[model samples]
Target chain A: MESHYFPIVYLFGNENLAVNLSNILMITVSMAIVFFVCFFMARKISMYPTGAQNALEYLVQFIKNIISSNMDWKQGKHFVMLGLTIILYVFVANMAGIPFELATQDHVVWWKSPTSDPILTISLAIMVIVLTHVYGIKMRGLKEYGKDYFRPAPFLAPFKVLEDLANTLTLGMRLFGNVYAKEVLMLMLVALGTSSLMWGIFAFLPTIIWQAFGVFIGSLQAFIFCMLTMVYMAHKVSADH
Target chain B: MSIFAIPYVRMNDKEANPLIQEFTWLDAIYQLAAFAVLLLLLKKFAFGPIMGMMEKREKHIADQISSAEKNREETEKQLAEQRRLIEEARREAKEIVENSRKMSSQQADEVLASAKQEAERIKETALAEIYQEKTQAINALREQVSTLSVLVASKIIEKEMDEKEQEKLIQETLKEVGEEL
Candidate 1:
């Protein structure tokens, strides 16, 4: 297997590092792309939306709908920016792997999906959850926020605490797992087909089909991630709900 | 060590599989910073201006609709006033026609009454004149008859009485005769 083509170690360092620099590079590039798209869309906003403005309006309204549905718009409006950032960043990061990766002279994979890295997903998850807690405390005060854990029954406080941990874990792991598996499957298919000429031609159909399915899954996961983040925030920020 | 050594130091070969990477603080910082920057930029350029434009357009439309409604109401009110004026004029015209008809009829009645009175006065003057002429003619005839009677008496008596006695006798005879006629 040519799996060694992906660098597992730092190209220059002797110290123990788990993350590859190339993964970070790809994530940075994906972020840049997301920034560019947003900047461009925002350049010519008008009272009457046309073409790209229409699409931008749709995206903005979509995020607004997700927020307003969960809680009062006054409270939920703050989360729109966070939600947009997550959806756009995750989508772009997820799509990074769709194109064939460029190989370096030292056999390091140049561009792979950033969401495939557990580090990025975990970071995003932690960030989202942390923000919810921060906003919850800010909106409800510390005493009120603390009282939320003992609701329904006082005995369930431990489980409630565990729920927070579990929510973050699942949120991060779900995205990481799906995106990683997609890349692994593609890698396996490519590896399987390229070994033999007849297998390569036959494998083309499955790879092409999986790639199309991957695009759908990628977008769906991004949407789900954003929606869940908003739902969790809404649960914490809302006084009664 | 330089500030850049942190990423490399964090990137270790202990987990040689790049696919399975440990969570590092730097990556979290980067992601958070990247997101923060994105949020700031988008909030400034995209959501702020777009929502404002939408609100502006909404307000403008509302204003236009309200103004149109006001104009329509004004036109309706003006039309009502005009109709009222027209109705008033029509009513006044009818009254004027009725008054003229009443005045002409009164004048005709007055003129007819005056003509009848004038004809009656003229007929009365003519009747008075005819009665005066008849009375004058009768008186003249009476005088002539007296004179003729006297002459006849003188011829028949043939101066039988004296002058004084004759005057007295003539008066008596004239009186008697006048009475008999």
Candidate 2:
């Protein structure tokens, strides 16, 4: 049962019993294992944090700092939830690419990054954009939101409205493009070495380089998603924007 | 923007493949759902603690700074007190030294005055003894001279009348010898 690299492997119904079971169960089990461990670690958090909780805190603090730095302590503090969610969820998605997809595949390719999928990326982006607007409207009433567009001149309001719309669309698309492009590039690089230059002396070097690049891009892209979320939110909720 | 979504097919060429994949509204819905999940998870656990810890860290740092400043001030104050104590001890030693010197000088002056008084008493007794001795010596000399004068007159009279004045002259000479002795 051969499959293209990172093809959407369905959870059930394949003719080969062994490979089908292997395909569906192993990756999901592994992800479930990661989820439960994270849950237990989260649940067991103490006043004096230990091991996994400490690691968790370090990640939490990192996002907290990012959010607080962008906005007011009170307003920024509220963004912590968003930051934490983005960091944790994206982190989980990014790490999904690490393990072997199935027991059958000699070189493991378990779970692809959820973030790499345009479906996932675009949804999160649009939500982030809408929430920013929602919070903006909440903070400064509908009148202020409308006034913000017309600010300094009543006539330039339409252009300003267009600019805002463009900005929101761009924000979402940018994240999708970056993550998708990085995943595609990594795949191509890996394919080039594994297929084309399998017997070539320099085959391993290119694969190694691209994998390293993949790791870097993956982490950066996750961070960028969260960063963009905070940036859009700050623009909306903050009085200055 | 919608042009990007349209298939880029080769209209002039007979052999061309249109791309199979297409973007759907379902994908957009999926994105929103994921974002909602992400936001929910963030709100529940992560945000509160991270922000709380940060605030705690900021407060802890501030406290440490204030305590450090307080400790420094206390140490400086202790050092000043120690220096002052040393200075005070030095002044006390000087006072003690000055007092001892004054006491010694006063004692010496008292001894000297007593010694001068003792010397005056001894001189006065000696002068009194010497006056008494001079008076005694003058009285004895007067008695001897008177007796000698009597004896001489008796001796001269005895020579003129040799045989008859012999007994009277002997009696006068005996009286002068007794006075001289």
Candidate 3:
């Protein structure tokens, strides 16, 4: 009962599929749209300036302004590109789920935010953690990488591995918990609104505001995730870090 | 339909318990394969080139902004220097005009004083010439009056004279006639 995150996983059809194929499609499509929009916005840049360039400039400035303020530019410059992709992609994917509804089979939720799923959140967190290690190795050679694991003592290397693992798992779990809980609340609330008449009118006012709030939270969480990625990298890569 | 309920919301509700089932290793493999395919597709068509360009353009923009800021600062410095130079030039021009004005006024005052002194000296010389002519005319008048007095005395005298005296008297009479003429 506790493990069931309704919107995250569901049956596809009588043919049957493992994951919620529809929700997964929503995620993939949303991510693709994020990628293409960012790409298209940046493809051409005029020396003078254009709308696309202006949009891209703002995106870049926004990321750099945050990254540079939070970390050293030399160590941090390479990070914004990765951070932007992750943040924008996740934000769009999360918000896209709000509008999802099923018309065919009444039981299925047509779409779900990818972050609401353990698999998606865990995958992303793993990506960030793996990248942190990869960048750490690149910045400081593999010798330093293994050596840092011993920091206080060589015997602590195993502990460091466990710590990193724990850290990654927490990252994924925290995101999944929040997104999944939000989806659950939304479903319950929406179900409550539709089950009656007076409740429906009362629910209408809040639903619009709550959906907007959801968008804000979705964007904030994505930003926080990306920001933490860079912060952890800054700690891991540099010797003084 | 049963797969969705594997993580069933209700453990006690008989409605969902029958749907709960253990996921097979084969299903996990299928999920892995599907994920691998998604990753591959993402790598080839989406993440690879798009991420590359995004990074490239991002770097280019950051560099351009920093460079532009540097140039703007340099231009501001140059502008400040030029402004200082222009101010100095204007100050010098004002000083030159003031000096020229002072020198011209001093020269004009000196010229007026000299012209006035020259006019006073010319008037004094003309007055001196008039006084000298008056003195010379007074001496000529005295000589004519004495000659006329001598002629009246000779006409009143009734006496004979020697030849030398008569000649002296005739010369005196001729002198009186010349004075009268």
**What TM-score does chain A reach in every model?**
0.92, 0.74, 0.84
Q: What is the DockQ of the complex in model 2? A: 0.08
lDDT per residue (tens digit) for residues B1-181 in model 3: 4555554221223345322232222333333344345445444544445445666876899999999999999999999999999999999999999999998898898888888888878877777776776656655755665455445545554256654775577668666765664
User: Under CAPRI classification, how is model 2 graded?
Assistant: incorrect
Report the lDDT tens digits of candidate 2 across residue range A90-170.
655655554312222432344555555554556566677777888889877898776787777889988877876776677
Residue-level lDDT of model 1, residues B80-125, one tens digit each, is 9999999999999999999999999999998999988898888888
TM-score of each: 0.79, 0.64, 0.57
Supply candidate 3's per-residue lDDT for A150: 86
lDDT of each: 0.79, 0.60, 0.66
- Superposition error at A172 for model 2 (Å): 2.2
lDDT of 1 by residue, A1-241 (tens): 4543334343224344334556668768987898778778778877677887778777878999989888889898888778888898899888888756566655556678878878779878998899999999999999989999999789999998999999999999999999988888887888888889999999999999888878988999999999999999998999997
> What DockQ would you assign to candidate 1?
0.31
lDDT of 1: 0.79
CA lDDT, candidate 1, residue B97: 97
Ranking by DockQ: 1, 2, 3
Model 2, B19-125: lDDT tens digits are 11223344345445544654554445544454466567778889999999999999999999999999999999999999999988988998998898889888888
**Which scores greater on TM-score, model 1 or model 2?**
1
